[model samples]
Target chain A: EAEVAQSPRYKITEKSQAVAFWCDPISGHATLYWYRQILGQGPELLVQFQDESVVDDSQLPKDRFSAERLKGVDSTLKIQPAELGDSAMYLCASSFGRGTEAFFGQGTRLTVV
Target chain B: ELKVEQNPLFLSMQEGKNYTIYCNYSTTSDRLYWYRQDPGKSLESLFVLLSNGAVKQEGRLMASLDTKARLSTLHITAAVHDLSATYFCANWVGSNYKLTFGKGTLLTVNP
Candidate 1:
């Protein structure tokens, strides 16, 4: 089945270390989303990308978190100085159109010590 | 702020029982989605309700949306042990395609 792809299913790093997560959306999907899900809480939108251009990033912490989608297909979310609170499942989803059903990736589980 | 809420937080059910999960949103929306997640796994799309009074069913789960009321329901009939998972409802906000997820309903079906 066609699915969104995410890398580094699990990662463990020291606090203040740099961490990055990668996602490859399904073919022909134009919208990509990044969400942070903490334990026992719903997923929160951190960023939204329409193709390679960022549509929204208000919820993302600009000082530490950054995301980019190059060539309008693959995306990368980076954290220059990861913090203890940054430990959560980073979920990536893609959809063909706005207000459409989004397909989610397996997500990258990051743990900062 | 647009928000989605699910009731009961957690549910314990016996196999072959019928139950319904409720989802209520805080704002106006025309689209809603239901997703299921197993322990330590990604989300699995269950249903998408795009209009008022939209109803869809698959397997043992039937989902209905009442857009006018800003509510949605996921009903399970004769649920089995394998149906144990976390269910989330996402409400589409405005035109940005951003979805606000509910706290999720954790269902545990005991045999």
Candidate 2:
């Protein structure tokens, strides 16, 4: 089975530093999503992309966080001047289209000191 | 806005015991999904409930959905140590691909 791939399974950085995470969705998937999971909470949607265009980013912290999928295939999420509270697991998921089941990646765990 | 809620945020049981995790949503949705996550790992899809009375089962875990009631359930039977993990239920916001998730239910099946 094809799976979504993520890089830097774990990242540790000092507060005020910049960090980025990468994700490659399964081939042919047109919908990609980025989610953040806190230690004791369920994942929350941060952004959604359709093809190479952003569909929704209402929950994303625009001031510090940014995500992009330039070619509608792979995506990158960056946090500038990371804060301690920004530590969490960043998960990537993809599906063939909207309103369908999505496959999740192993996720990148970020920690800010 | 859509909201999802799961009850019994934490559960502890011994081998052979049975328990159920409940998921309730605030609005009508197109589908409901259940996922399991082990510590320090990613999510594993457990079930996808798409219709009013959809139900699916795999091994010792069974999930049921009732769209009329806007509820879904994950039932574990004869649990084992391998079942120790956090389970999450998420609902697809109408028409959109976005999902609203409930606070996960952490299950600890003690041997």
Which candidate achieves the best lDDT against the true structure? 2
Clashing pairs for predicted structure model 2, backbone only? none
Q: In angstroms, what RMSD does candidate 2 have relative to the true structure?
A: 1.0
How would you encode candidate 2's per-residue C-alpha lDDT over B84-107 as one tens digit per residue?
999999888855658778999999
Write down the lDDT of every candidate, Cα atoms only: 0.92, 0.93
Considering every candidate listed, which one attains the maximal TM-score? 2
A1-113: candidate 2 lDDT, tens digit per residue: 89999999999999999999999999999999999999988999999999999999998999999999999999999999899999999999999999888999999999999
Q: Give all TM-scores, in the order shown.
A: 0.97, 0.97
- Candidate 2 wrong stretches, greater than 4 Å: none
- Candidate 1 residue pairs in clash (backbone atoms < 3 Å): none
| Consecutive 10-residue window with the lowest summed lDDT within model 2 chain A | A94-103
Q: Under CAPRI classification, how is model 1 graded?
A: high
**Residues B7-66, candidate 1, lDDT per residue (tens digit)?**
979999999999999999977887889999998888899999989999999999999999
User: Cα miss at B68, model 2 (Å)?
Assistant: 0.2
Error of 1 at B35 (Å): 0.1
